[model samples]
Target: MNEIVTTRLKPVSANLSRHKGVRRHAAIFIAPALAVYLLIVIAPSIGTLWISFTKWKGIGDEAKFVGIDNYKQLWNNDTFRGSFGRTLTLLIAGGFVVFLFAFIFTMLIREMRSKKLIRAIVFFPNVVPPVALAIAWGVLLAPRNGLLNEFLELVGLTSQTRTWLGPDLLFRSIIAGLVWIYTGFFVTILMAGVDRIPAYYYEAAELEGASARQKFTRVTLPLTWDVLSVAAVLWVILAIKTFEFIYAFGGSGTDPSASSWTLPVHVYVVALGNRSPILALGQGSAIAVVMVALVGALIFLTRRVMRRAVVEF
Candidate 1:
């Protein structure tokens, strides 16, 4: 009887094992997307990082291994260094202006009677294409006959009516142009964050007789911090990779006279300009590598420093 029972159980165990195998096969089918991501996204990013360690002219057959030479050039090259400096300046100044405007606009809209209309108007700039926004800004800030200069001249402030895109005002003008183009997007982001906060928090603070400033400082700031940090990261990345607004508004190509060139422009000037193909490719790739490193470091550090504390709300 025992031998017969063991023989009957063997077939049942085999079928159960086959079912487990089928489940494992299904799991494998489900994993193809992740595998593709590892190959496509993760692999390429790692490859670019490796290329940065090499002196690969963009069209080269073989990359010359030059560990840290590209980084060294970034530190020593005046033009590259200057562009990096301008990038940092924009990151801080432009980033702050966008954040401030976004925050104020979002708050004001929330308090408005016609909130939807106000929100739509505020977000209008974001709907406009970046290139068109750039062109419009160029017209507005044009040195001689710009709307700004015209207004300044009317006020008898002739000194302030000077060239907006000239070397002296190039950086600030670019910052302002970028702020105009980007503040709307930031405002929309902040508004979404603001919408998530519980109204009860404000009500409780109001009942406590908290001044407006105190309420903002104690209640609003901390609660909104997580979203604001996300916005900051986005702004930081945009500032580092600022190409469109500067390229379009500052001038079509690298303006030798304009002080607004950032790293992307620097890379274009070095790699794609009418200069010798070899030098252009070499220096361009080098600059590209450095820009990647700088931006990567910033993002990493930012994530480390500003990683949001999880809130129960």
Candidate 2:
């Protein structure tokens, strides 16, 4: 009985030692990545939070503590309020439009014979530099000799031609351009989710005399809910940080007009004093803090709203 007990204990001890060795190796591999994240992401986030409570010119001058004053001033600033409102609009309305078109394109492409080529074409714009795209849009929408206005005149719809890049329509044009640029990206993601679905599910739905819309509503949507939720969160982050395209679209060499400014652009203008008389690095930091909070709250709410029981195959 003693010999048998010793034999069993030997194997158990060996297995435990092996498991510990595996964990140690894993930690060794993860340490470098963890250190990099701490250095770049975590450290800067803490610095930004600290800076939000102080006044500084971001160069030469020392920072002076001013408790909540930056936040209070930002709250009362009309420019900041407008930028915040525009940011929200882009996150919500732009997300809706992007997802709507993505779903439509995904449905169409799923049944097409040349889907791979079509997807490449659709995704091409996304890979192009945003600055170039914005410049192209500006050229197409220029008031006098723009391509769009020229097309309108060629079609004998000259009356429909207007100054698309002017103050009256600039914001709308920017929104439309963003939708066009991002729709393909979401389509690629949604299509990936859709492709993972088993064909037999659709076949089974068809045997029950289901229509195309019924199959999509009952089968496709449920299985892809997880992917859609993640994509929505990604859109929120991207929309909030969008600056280059809008900046290039509206500005020649100076800051864009206030009507088209979003939160990121507002942060830049405040912190860098681009065409502005004064730089307010602390106020810009406050805006950054607000943006971080907004992202966290929206992500939490999105997860809550989109949560559902996983649909097993």
Can you write out model 1's per-residue Cα lDDT over 164-261, one digit (the tens) per residue?
77788878888888887788888888888888889999899999999988877887778878887788888878888878767766664334443667
The residue pairs that clash in candidate 2, if any, are none
Q: In model 1, where do residues sit more than 4 Å from their true spots?
A: 1-44, 54-63, 253-258, 274-279
* Candidate number of the best TM-score: 2
lDDT of 1 at 222: 81
Ten-residue region with minimum lDDT total, candidate 2 = 272-281
Give candidate 2 misplaced runs (Cα > 4 Å). Answer: 1-17, 273-277
Clashes of each: 0, 0
Which whole-number lDDT from 0 to 100 does residue 201 have in model 2?
91
lDDT of each: 0.77, 0.90
Please report how far candidate 2 places residue 144 from its true position, in Å.
1.3
